[model samples]
Target: MFDVKIVNGHILDGTGNPWTKLDIGIINDTIVEIGQLKDAPSKETIDAEGLVVSPGFIDTHVHSDLLCLRPEVHKIKVMQGVTTELFGQDGISVAPVSSETKPIWQKQLKGLNGDIGDWPWESIDDYLSYLEQSDLIGNNTYLVPHGGARTLVMGFEGRKATKEEMTEMRKIVEKGMEEGAVGVSSGLIYPPNIYSDKEELIEICKGAARYDGCFVVHIRNESNKSLEALEEVIDVARITGVRLHVSHFKVAGELNRDKFTKSLQLMDEAREEGIEVTFDQYPYTAGSTVFHSILPPWMHEGGTEKLLERLKDKDVRNRIKEDFLHNEDYENWVRNCGWENIVIASVGSEQNKEAENKNMLKIAELWNTTPEEAAFDLLLEEEANITMIAHWGDEEDLIYGMQHPLQVVGSDGIFGGKPHPRLFGTYPRVLGEFVREKGALTLSEAVRRMTGAPAQLLRLKDRGLLIEGYKADIVVFDPTTVKDRSTYEEPLLEPVGIKYVLVNGLLAVKDEQFTGMTAGRVIRSGVATPVN
Candidate 1:
């Protein structure tokens, strides 16, 4: 008798193989059999008669970096059939921080990761071990953030690293890999990381590559300078012999939207030249991040407190505003999308909570102040503790970019003040709109993007595929009924199609509801799972 039997389903199998009618049986945490299983005895039998069973979605660029600590992790992720996810993305995260650097990271990363009570986060291994030992809902994977590595070795100064400092940074990357990171990641627009020259990044990637890690980057610019940013990462991959992956690759702003094809062709050309590269993207036409990220990089110098001090100084504030006036070197997200399109996604305090889901212009009117003054004061009051979703993408560009073979699915998803609907709707939306409706990709192709492709990148041989010996991480959904219910006005509504999800053979979601089974594991690079 099998522990759990899923019967009469059309299986996609995550391998880009054609859908085949099969029944999958699981015992403990591994699939015991795959084929006809009529009359099979089991503790549970999921009737997947009209469902499409694919491997549970693997979200490769999630900012749920700290959600493993709370029960909400199950609610936000497992309900959407996300059985595994990559955290520590975009180069800023909590691991590898010291007693002194912890405070700085908490402040710098406040927008991405809210404050945490006392938890042992001294090293990347400590953080991973804590998750492994906890009641986590999904398999958690991590990349050593280059932002944290840079801050630890050189502080947040906007200057090139010395040779010795570069060596020290390499050591931090080496130690993070020993702690079991799949790779290293960077946010080039963020502080300290912005200070790193190409030479420094190459050295960082070299260090990560010694442990067979890839470099996942949030490129320097995605708007007007998007092509140039692509060239920079391609250069890193070519020169350092490192595998490269772009996090949420997109061309923003109306001026550069048409260059989308040229940008992707550049990556294709790089592959022809033997530089390995791939990219991830969400289906939505909007993007989310810290509200203060739109400011000139110089404004983020020193640290969050110093930046807050500058924001309060009228002269300094005016000087910074002039950069926006001149359309300076910075990739100002607000200017690219227009201030009215930048809506408040989250806030730091209760008093400011009323501004949640409201745009900057709207918030300004409520405060009886100019939008400029309101933006500055909001940053100062919250210590730049705000996040925003900018409605900045072009539809043709989005569909074109997502259709490329190099593009895989990732939810640059976050949870906080009025989060982007992508957080709740990414996987289902692609299934419903892209595959089921538009026919942009077949079901097998989309499943491979979310599953087999990423599992190959993470070097997980057994998890992503739904073969007999693989781990029992699976999703069952109705192709006809699967649809994303979340929208801009109501962002947190659960998706409608996924009926059941299992994490390591235990039911995490059944009948589209969480089953309170936190049976997920922490996956580290080069760590072997006993497969039979």
Candidate 2:
């Protein structure tokens, strides 16, 4: 008998093909049959009349590294129909940490990934093993963060690695891939990763390529130097033969908007040259990240603690202000998008909670200080745990990227106070606004980007589709009614029209309510099962 039967649904199948009317039968954790299954015996049956049953969305980029360990808080992703998520993004995350570096990473990542008190695991294998024992709402995969790997060999040092140190770092990454990381990810705009030169990236990519792993990166620059940044990573991929994926790919700042087309042309040229490359992007004009990123890379040289110490210095503050105004070498957030366009999204301290949704300029006005000082003071008070949203592009540019053949959906969601609405609304927004409302993309094509495309990129063997023999990771939603309700003002509001979701064939969400059943497994590279 079937474990669960879903009948009267239009199946999209995640293959970029038009939908077909069908019914699905699930037993245990796999889809046992896909046909007319209305009379199939089952423990539970869902009448998915007028709903689209497609593969549950795979979030290719997320900052849920620590949040995934906390079952209650992390269900937000699954609630929005995400059945699997990729963590260890932008070259920094939990896991593979030494006792000495663990505290440092905890502070550095607190604003981005949140602090869950103390982490109990120290390696990729240990971290995945812990996830195997946790009550996870959806499946999770990881990348060997370049920053974390570098920290294991050298504790957030900002200098070139010697020959021996380079070999050691490569070994660290190779070991992580062996432990089941899908790839290696680096955020070139962040510390440790920002310190790495082109040669260092080639060495790291070589290690990941040994396991046929992909190299996912947030390239060095996304504004004025955007095209040059793309060329750098493309060159690394060419040298190492590592599968390359860009994270939250976008050209930031109004002045840099014209470079978007040229960037796409470069990616196309690389593909023509037989270089395997792909990218993920959220459907938003603004970008979000830790507020400390506004400071120059040199300020983050010694890690979060040293950064805080430097922030307290008058001379350092002066240097930082000068860099924010003039630096074109690094990602100058303040210069690309003004302080008025940069709004505080979240803060770690209750004392500054009122500034959550206010722009830096307004906050500075309230504090009766300069915008730079207000930013510095906030970082000092919060000990560097602050998140911000900077308005970067227009909807026209967002739609242009969305229509690209290589693009996939990744929320790049950062949690905590007045978070980007993409955190809660990304998937539905695409399905509703882009696909349904605007006709920017067809429904079948949109689902493919969120499902089959990412699944193929990550090398998930049996997920991301609705084939009879595949795992039953599915989402049932009303096409007519599905839409994201979350906004900048009401970022916590849940999306509408995602009626049911299944993870590993277990009903995790029914009628938009969580079933409290944690059937998620820690998916590893080339395998759908947990690490054993």
Candidate 3:
């Protein structure tokens, strides 16, 4: 008798193979058999009569490390059919942080991570061990956040690393990898990390590559500096011979819209030059980040207290606002730039909880001031804690980009209330809308993108496939009904049509409901190439 038998299902087998009729048998947490199973007996039998079973979806980009410590880990993501997720993208994470720096790190990332209770570890390995003890509901993976590590070793000051500092940083990456972090990640567009030049990155990539890990970067900026950032990433890959994964590789702002195709051409060119480059982007045009991210790097050099001091100085505030005025859209007094479309995804401090859905642009208009000044004031009032969805994407660009072979789907999601629906709907949106509904990709091809492609990039062994001996991580859904219900307004709504989701062979989500089970394991990269 089999431990569990899923009978009469259309198996999509994550290999991009042709769909086949099969009965999958699971014994404990592994798929024990496939194909005909007419007489198979088991402790449990699921009559998957009309369901289309595929490998459980894997989210390549997630910011759920600290948030998953919450009681439910937000069942919204699990119910949407994501069985496994890679956390620590764009560099901010709980691991690799010393206890002394954890609080400051938490506060700095509060807008992105939302408020969470105290963390238990000061290092990546310890954090992973603590997570293993948590009542998590789904599979969670870890990445050594370069920003977190840098902040721990050097604080938030923008400076070049000393020789000893470089040694310390390399040790941090090595320790995290030894403890199960899949790779190294950076947020170069954000804080102290932005201070790092190409040579520093090359050194760090070399360390990560020693652990067979990849380097993932929230590339410098997709604006005027997009090409420069791309050049920097390619240089790192070239210098260190590391694998490069570009996070949210979109060209933002209307001015950069025409540069989207050019960005792809650049990446393709890098690939041709033997630089292993891949990128992930959400299907949305507008991007979301902390409002404080717009602050000058110098203003944020010392941390929150220093930033608050600068905010209090009228001269400093005016000087900063003067610089921001050149941005045009936000310079016009009382202009509601993207307000109608800007949904407040998260608010970090107790004082700013009321700003969760109110528009910053509208608030600027109410104060009869420039949007930049309004943003500064709002962030200052909340201690630089706010999140906003900037409406700045072109649908044509999104569609065209997703069609690219090297482009994989990513939500770039924050685990917070009213967060971008991409967190809950990315995989299904690609599977149902883009693949089935729009006919942009064959179902097998889409599955490969969400499953195999990312698994390969992260170098997760034996995952992202449906082979008999592989892990029994699977999903069963109805393609016709598998549509994302979470819209821009009702961003927290759950998706429909996913019937079951398994992580490491245990049902994490069943019948479109969370089973309150976590069967995830941290994946450490074993490649010897530099990970960028």
Candidate 4:
């Protein structure tokens, strides 16, 4: 007898093809059959009469590095139909650290990745092993973080790495890949990573290339110098022959919106020249990240403690204000999108909790000070543990990017107080608004982007497709009524019309309610074998 049988559903199969009426049979954790199985005996049966059955969605970018350790909080992803996620994004995460660098990274990443207290894991192998032993709500994978490696070798210094340091960093990356990292990632706008030049990046990409791993990057500048940033990574990919994946690709700011088309042209040219380039984008005009990211990179040279010290000095604060106003060399969020467009999303301290969900301008008015001063005080009070959402791109640009042939869906979701609505609504919004309402893309194509495309990119041998003998990770939902209920004003609301979700042949979400089952596995690169 089969372990479970789901019958009478229209199967999309995650192949970018039209749906076919079929039934799926599961035995243990594998999809045993996918044809006529209505009369087949099974231990359990699900009647999915009018639902669409497709492979469970894979989130390409997420900040769930520590959150995954807490399934109660991490189930939000499964509630939205995401059964797998890629972590170690933006070149900062919770692995491959020396004991000396652990506390420093912990403090620097508290705003973006919430604090989970001290753990005993240091290397990528240790971290992955910890996940394997944890009660995970979904499958998790990781990329070796560039900043983590840099800090491990040299303690957050902002100078160019010497030849010996470069060799050390490269070896760290190679070890991570050997320990089962799918790729290497760098956030060029963040500290330590920002200190790296093109040569450093080339050396690092070569390490990833040795294992045929992708080089995923959040390029240095996404505003006025976006094209140059894109070209910089493209050139690295060219020189190192590393497969390249750009993270949350966009041209931010009103003045830089016109550069969106040219950015796509560059990507197309790169692909034409035989670079395996792809990108993931959230379907939104506003982007969210740590509030401290708005400051100049130089200010973050020595780590969070040093950054806080600089923030206390009057002269340093003034220099920061000047740089925010006139700096084109770094990403100047204040100059591109004013303080009015930057809204505080989360703060760590109880004293600063009132600032959450308020724009910097509003908070400034409430404090009777300039917006810059208000932000500085908040960062100081919260110990730089704050996050913000900035309204940057246009809806038209977002749609155009979504329609690109190489584009895939990623929520870029960060979990915390008054977080971005995309955290709760990205997948549903794409299905309901982009597909059912505006017809921007067919439902099949949308599912393909969320499923098959990311699977191909990550080189998952058996996941991301609804085929016989594959893992039974699947989602069942209604196309007519699926919609995202979360908004910027009410960001915690869950979605509607996701009927059921299954992970590893077991029901994780049955009839729209989570079953409290922790059946997830830690997927290592090139280690997953197809279930026969």
Candidate 5:
């Protein structure tokens, strides 16, 4: 008898091809057979008559490291049919660290990931080992965080790395990559990483390229100089011959939205010049991140302790206020952060619960002050640690981005007490809202973008496609009924029409509910050998 049989489903196969009817047979953890199975016997048979059976979704950009440590994180992702998630995004993760840098990183990243209790592991392999022993939700792939590596070797100081310090950091990257890390990541817009120059980046990325890996970067800026940031990324790829992937690619400022065509043309021009480049973006019109991201980059050089101290000085505060007023696109930034569109999603301080769903502009008006002053007071009151959303980007910008052949999808949202809905609703919104309802893309093309495309980018062999002898990581869903129920007001609701989600032939989500199963394993890269 077969181990399990999913009968009579229209198979999409994840190749952007036409749907074909087939019966899928699974045994242990692999797809044992496909096609006619009329005479096959099985332990259990699922009647998926009206459902579309395809490879489980793969999330390209994710920040669910600590969130997945909680048991229910898998449920939130699996119910939307995501079987695998790429963690260690935008250069922040909990690996490749030293004891000295652990506490400093925890405080530096307080606004990004809240309240990390303990340092569970030291190296990338060690961190993955800890997750393997814990109750994780799905398969996780990791990358060596360049920002964390810098913090470990060179504290939060804004200085160039000496020869010895550079060597130490490169050794850490080599060890993590040897232990199966996919690549290295950097967040140039954030501190520590922002302090690094082109020489430092090129040296490290050359090592990553030696292993046939890609370096992913959250570009230096996402606002007025976004095009220049894109060019800089291309320059890095050209200098080191490292494959490049840009995180959350979008034109953010209101005036910059008109330059989408120009930015895309530049990317197209880069690809033609033989620089391998790809990008991921969420489908929403509004973007979200910590409110302090608007601060002048230099003001955040020394990390949180120094930032808090600077916030208390009268002269410094006045200087910062003047700088905010005189910013080149200050009005566009204000419009992007519309009071009604900006929501207080999470806060470290207990006093912040009352501010949820309220906008920064409204709060500023209530206090009879400028928005920057209101933001400063709120951050100071909350100890420079709060998470807020920016209502930026136009719908046309998002649609134009997705229509590109090279673009993939990702949710920049991460979880805390209460989080943005994209973490739970991104995949469903794409399939239901854009493809099924709005007809933005055909069903076949949407499946390809979610599954096969990202898997190919990660070089995940025997996954993201349905065929015999491959891992039985699959999902069964009804395209017509699938929809995302989560919104800004209520961000934790589950999606509909996803009936079954499997990881390695085990049911992670069954009947639209999580089974609390934990059978995920960490994926590693192939070994690098010397060229003759």
Candidate 6:
């Protein structure tokens, strides 16, 4: 008898083709058959009449590293039918830590990646194994974090790596890859990742290249000189022959959103010259990040404690204000988007929870002070753990980027107070609003981008498609009613119309309710490669 039989579903198969009616048979965790199975015996049966059955969504960029450690917290993805989520995004993860820098990274990363308090893994293998031994909700993939390795070797020092240091970091990357990391990631907007120049990046990429792993970068800049930043990464990819993947690709400031067309031209040129380049973007105009990130890079040299000290000093705050108001060289997101555009996504303190989702300008008005003073006061009070959302992109550019062939979807949101709506809404919004509502993409094309395309990028041969013998990672949903209910004002709400989700033949979500199953596996590069 088959383990489970799903009959009468219009199967998309995640191949970018039109839907075809088929019955699917599952034995254990593999899709045993894909054709007629009506007469076949089965232990369980699902009538998928009038519904679409497709491969579960693979989130190309997700920051659920520590959140996944808590079982029910992952319902944010499962409710939307995400089967696989690739972590170690924007260049910071919990693993590959050294004894010296372990405490430092744990605190520094808390601004965006929430606390993991005393969890026991330092090396990549140990970290991945810890998850495997835990109660997981969905399949997870990891990338060797460039910043984590840098912290181990450089300790938040804002300087280019010495040749020996670079070699040491290279070994870490290679070792992580050997132990099953799919790639390496660099968050250039966040330092000391920003400290690395082109040559250093190429060196790191080379290690990932050896294992046929992807080199994913959150590029150095997304504002005024965005094209130049794009060029730098493209050249790095060209020189190293690394499979390049750009994370959460967007021209963030209002001043640069119009330049996205030119940016696309540069990427197209790079691809034409034989660089394997792709990018992921959330379908939102507003972007979320730590509010402290807007300060001058020099102020961040010694990490959050020093930054907090600077925030409290009147003279230091004034000097920073002067430089920000006058400097034309550096791309300051706050200045470019205007104070009115910055909204508080969350704060570290319980008393300030009421400030969640309020814009900086509104807070300033409420406190009877300038936005600059209000911001500094907030940072000083919260100790640099305030997160903000900037309303700063052009709708035209967002649509243009989404229509590109290499574009895949990602939710760059994390768990905490008043997060971005994309945290719970990205996949459903793409399907309902982008596909069914606006017809921006056909159901087949959107499904392909969400599933098959990401699978191809990560070289995950077994999980992205709903073919016979592939892993039974599948989603069943109604095309007519699937839509995201989460909004910026009500960010934590779940989605609607996702009927069921399966991870490796086990139901994780059934009829929009979590099945409370821990069927997730810590997927490794090439299916569990051993470290040398």
Against the hidden true structure, what lDDT does model 3 obtain?
0.76
Q: Candidate 3, residue 453: CA error in Å? A: 0.7
* Segments of candidate 5 deviating more than 4 angstroms: 162-167, 328-341, 366-369, 528-532
Candidate 4, overall lDDT? 0.92
Q: Rank the candidates by lDDT, best first.
A: 2, 4, 1, 6, 5, 3
lDDT of 1 by residue, 1-532 (tens): 8999999999999989999999999999999899999688888899999899999889999887776667665476888889999988888888888887888888888787766665577799998998888888889889989988888887788889998888888888878887889889999888868778888888888878788788999998888888888899999989878789999988888887766888999999999999889999999989999888878888888878888888878898788778766663667886788889899999989989988899889999999998788889898888898999998888778888878998899998887878889989999999999999998889899999999988887778689889888999999999998888988889989998899999999998889888888898888887322111
Write the residue-wise lDDT of candidate 5 on 1-532 in tens digits.
Answer: 7788898899989889989988999999899999888579998888889999999888888877767777665468888888888877777677877888777777666666666588778888888888888777688888788877887787788877887777777777777777787788888867778778777787678667767777888887676777887888889899878778888888776767766777888889989999888888888876666666666666777777787788788788787776665654222344444455666677777876666657876777877887667777787888766777667778877888888888877777677646778877888899899999888888888888888888887888888999899898999999989999988888888889899988999998889988989877777777544111
CA lDDT of each prediction against the hidden true structure: 0.86, 0.92, 0.76, 0.92, 0.79, 0.86
lDDT of model 5, residue 176: 75
lDDT of 6 by residue, 1-532 (tens): 8898889989998889999899999999999898989999999888889999999999988888988988778778988989999988877778889787778777777878787688698899999999999988999998999988888888888788898898888888989998889999998878668678888888888788888889888888777877888899999889878888988888877566667888888888888999999999898998888888778777777667777877878898898898668754455777778888899998888977877888888999988999889889888888787888888888778878899988888888778889989999999999999899888889999999899999998999798999888999999999999999999999999999999898899988888889898788899998344222
The residue-level lDDT of candidate 3 at 36 comes to 93
Candidate 4 lDDT over 263-355, as tens digits, reads 999999999999999999998899999999999998999999999989999999999999988989998899998999999999998888889
Q: Count residue pairs with overlapping backbones in model 5.
A: 0
Which 10 consecutive positions of candidate 6 have the poorest summed lDDT?
Answer: 523-532
Q: What is the lDDT of candidate 1?
A: 0.86
- Residue pairs in steric clash, candidate 3? 96-124, 212-527, 214-531, 215-531, 215-532, 242-530, 285-393
Look at candidate 1 and tell me the lDDT of residue 270. 97
On the 0 to 100 scale, the lDDT of residue 300 in model 6 is 76
Error of 2 at 209 (Å): 0.8
As for model 4, its CA RMSD to the true structure in angstroms is 2.2
